[model samples]
Target: MRTNSPETKKTARELRNDPVLSKEYTKNKIQFQNYYFKLGYQWSKPDLNSIVCRFAVLIQVIRIKREELTESFIEYDTRFLGGNFQIPDSKELLLLIFLNAPLYQVFTTLRKCSKRKEKYYKDRVGQRFEIQIGYE
Candidate 1:
């Protein structure tokens, strides 16, 4: 649980607005303000509903209950979702797996979305436009 303060947010704003860092951050699409709050020790509990709302915009991501998370939770979730287990000898590695689980899904979903083709048709006469008509 990270804590955020107004002073910290102001500092982050300055850093994010810096020319060099701002370019790099924009190129990487890194939200410095968000990361600042996440790393801040005084930040409040994350809003799970916000995650869901973002997902509703075709983000294809979701946050599980914090109670449902554990070090080995990622491995367990992978097995549950894929019906298999990964053989890892290190317990530490197993614990770290959960933290990155969302990453795998997020990348995969983004790739899939990118590869999809948008369908279009000619409505009347040689005019290309999208249509929303009866499926019958």
Candidate 2:
């Protein structure tokens, strides 16, 4: 008989609780807080739970989809993003895909992220992260 392997991350909540995730998000505490900023709640308030949770889920989904598409893990670069622009999740993975993947994979990798609307993020983040890397 055969069995499937377990998921590395079942949900965003699990990732959020991870010490590594905590360390990365905490780099710019204020920015993370602002991601869920509520008029009255602000940071350190229980009222912000759902809002923060939503972003957490989004983060988890994006990371997962990107990984699945790339067929490899990705991570934020320790060095500053080479371009003048900065996004919350560094474009390190995108660069790796563009530079290394086959043309078809590269096109798919680039297109997958923007296939949806209402998820465009244009900003800088200092969070640090590293995901496993291997080419299939």
Candidate 3:
């Protein structure tokens, strides 16, 4: 797993120093809310990662254990989006986490994951993956 713990370490320092990052974060939050208001697929929202992290924190505040967060996500997904995903659905969760996680934490986690992937195989950076549908 990528290490996002570094982000947690810098949270106080970043909050104290950078007004720009803070403004960007606040702007993203509003964009996320507007996306939800439009009734777009929840996946289309921009600040999904932050939302996920927020939910994790919320669960803790509600006296739920961190160990139960995955199960809670499953429950929340089923209730809001119809059913639990067959595979781990981190795309949406990542978006929420990114938004909710401290900026430094998000970047660190992404960097670690990228490095780990590179260690296993040569990656084609900028390669595009697409899907095409044929209708009869």
| Cand. 2 Cα-lDDT | 0.27
Superposed model 2: Cα runs more than 4 Å off: 1-111, 115-124
Strongest candidate by lDDT: 3
Question: Residue by residue across 7-42, what tens digits does model 2's lDDT show?
Answer: 544555577888766545532211221221221223
Model 1: per-residue Cα lDDT over 36-117, one tens digit each: 1111112254443332111101222232333444545443333322243333333222111011122332211111111111
Ranked by TM-score from best down, the candidates are 3, 1, 2
RMSD of each: 19.9, 17.9, 16.0
Misplaced by over 4 Å in model 1 are 1-3, 26-136
Predict model 1's lDDT versus the native: 0.27
lDDT of each: 0.27, 0.27, 0.29
Q: In model 3, how large is the Cα lDDT of residue 128? A: 18
CA deviation > 4 Å runs, candidate 3: 1-70, 77-80, 89-96, 100-136
